[model samples]
Target: MFSHIILGARDLAALAAFYDPVLAALGLQRMPDEDDGGPAGVGWQLPGQRLPQFFVQLPFNGQPASAGNGTQVSFLAASREQVDAAWAAALAAGGVDEGAPGVRPRYAADYYGAYCRDPEGNKLCVVCWG
Candidate 1:
């Protein structure tokens, strides 16, 4: 449904530090530094695929990066364990907990997910559907 999703960040290095491990937990690998010369940022995508990338970078407007209210990005996990691992990685990498890993029956009978805010306060969710 999307080509890519980019989150604005004030600190590119800090964003990489937080996203590297967290995305790894969900089996996403950071793309090699091709230095596209577009902007200062980093991106990650599922191994061996090209589209649907996730990126964190400075705002193009040259202003401070701020999280949009009610905005969120959700990633699909292969299993509940991946959801837990991603959540753990997020918190360990300077993210804050928004919700712990658990079943969210309200979403679905097999919904298991966790939520956290990135170091820059962007909301994220890791979810698994059994």
Candidate 2:
């Protein structure tokens, strides 16, 4: 029953720069033109879908970042390579490795995945070939 997701970033410019190429690699496109009134930067849209669009706005105005505050956001990949690439990209973007990429039979026999904390410390994951 979810409609959309928005995350707060202390640095919109940094977040945008980090996510642009990384998400694009997964076929997600940044919404064009709109600049959420400047300080509140906006982007984040999946490719080829006009509806059910999701956007992530940056900066929470001095509020504490809730990145890895026990919250996890997982993205699916088409193959193991994508998972690896995602992990590397995330690390390059200031993501800290929470878990290395591998199968977690406890989650599922084929649950191949990697976990990381975003710049804001939000727990994130990428998975594929599961």
Candidate 3:
């Protein structure tokens, strides 16, 4: 249903560095040839699973990037182990922890997930729905 998501990042390089490994751990790869020039950010997408793309870039209107309250972008994982790996990768890349890897019973019985904020303060969630 969604074509793509582009989160504003004051520092595009920092956001990309922070997310590179996190996305890789979930089997997503950055599109190296995806530079659109003005205020464009890096893009990542699942191999063979196109349409939905994730990007980090400066605000198109030249506004400073700010984290929105209660706003988050969640990435789906393939396994519980991937969730754990992604959480660790995020931390290693300077992300702050919002939640550790484990079953979020409130979301579902098998909703294993981890939550964190990117270097730019954008909220993120990685989950594996069993």
Best by TM-score: 1
Q: What lDDT tens digits, residue by residue, belong to model 1 across residues 1-130?
A: 7999999999999999999999999899999877776668899999889888999988888899999999999999999999999999999999999999999999999999999999888999999999
- CA-lDDT, candidates in order: 0.94, 0.72, 0.90
lDDT of 3 by residue, 1-130 (tens): 6899989988888888988999999889998765567777888998888878988888989989999899999998899999999999999999999999999899899899999998888899999999
> Which residue pairs clash within candidate 1?
none
lDDT of model 3 at residue 111? 92
In candidate 2, position 61 carries an lDDT of: 72
Off by over 4 Å in 2: 35-39, 51-54, 59-64
Return the lDDT, model 3, position 11.
Answer: 87
lDDT of 2 by residue, 19-100 (tens): 7766765667788866445446656666777644444565457564456456787777788888888888888878889998
- Which scores higher on lDDT, 1 or 2? 1
Ranking by lDDT: 1, 3, 2
- What's the candidate order when arranged by decreasing TM-score? 1, 3, 2
Q: Candidates 2 and 3: which is better by lDDT?
A: 3
- Give the per-residue Cα lDDT of candidate 3 at 127: 92
